[model samples]
Target: PNLLPEQVTGTRIVSQGRRESDYNLIGLTDPRGNKYYWIGPQHEGELLRHDDTDYHAIGDGAVSVTPLHVDLTHEGALKSLREAFG
Candidate 1:
């Protein structure tokens, strides 16, 4: 397959871990217990403010996006099994 310009011109990433605490800014919690962050664009300037609050900002404002996956199979398994039983 041919590579798109955007895909070819993005910054490379190395995953350290998935927990929100691993990378403070990458995953943050707000006062209301809601998480808000950029999937592929974060200002370098705001990186410093991560420690001030639970709010996190991730994915350097680059040309690419990396998706984080959390396993929901355990929770969904019962539903899946029920559906299969029918």
Candidate 2:
């Protein structure tokens, strides 16, 4: 594929050390399965805020793969909390 897929923990938009926003916007898919996004105010949204993520993974010419787990519970926290309050 022309667009190489890169895995990222999350996506975000930043102006500096200060984060401007999480990755917002959507991409359009053509009949040929090519994806593209239009720059507009309407496309922005509050989506993600995961730190330790690199924008280059999902930037202009790259594809991003964010692997998510089905179980969202923190195992260590769950165990400790159970023991403390059980």
Candidate 3:
């Protein structure tokens, strides 16, 4: 998942083996300074299941590329702020 410059500074990832802490996984910066995060495949299953074939491909040493887009708006918070200020 790609994040806008404002949202990129304080992002966190909480998963098994990874503590719930700030993660600086930003890939690169363009001329405009947008930040990109390479979030791996989204899948369901503790162990490898047939439906997780795409994720499995990575485990087998195959190169995988998943594209993503950036959405900067925090919808729920934005709505609350709008109501409060309006």
Candidate 4:
């Protein structure tokens, strides 16, 4: 087809290492002035600092994709909380 399907968001099912590579491949800036990349899948809870750069597989019959934003604002909430508490 010459035109792309409306249901397709251009996203594909990627695997380990590949996902990480894609995540860190390049920085993509969105319309909201936020830059981000694919960072594997984050099903629940926040990602641990040590595990942030790791990739995981979803074998639970569910497809979860994590889009990690490349912006200082990512830690804005934590930074502000620390300042407020201190």
lDDT against the true structure, each candidate:
0.44, 0.51, 0.47, 0.44
How does each model score on TM-score? Answer: 0.20, 0.24, 0.30, 0.18
**Candidate 1 lDDT over residue span 1-86, tens digit each:** 13555544444343322232233346777999999874543433333333222122223323333355786677688889889996
Candidates 1 and 4, the one with greater TM-score: 1
In model 2, which regions exceed 4 Å deviation?
1-41, 44-69
Q: After superposition, how far is residue 65 of candidate 3 from its true place, in Å?
A: 1.7
Stretches off by above 4 angstroms in model 3 are 1-55, 70-72
Candidate 3 lDDT by residue in tens digits, 1-86: 24345533332222212113333444776779987675543433254323234344434343334444689999999999999998
Give the Å error, residue 70, model 1: 2.8
Clash pairs of candidate 3?
Answer: none
Scanning candidate 1 in windows of ten residues, the lowest lDDT window is 49-58
Better of 3 and 4 by TM-score: 3
What is the Cα-based lDDT of residue 9 in candidate 3? 36
**Candidate 4 overall lDDT versus native:** 0.44
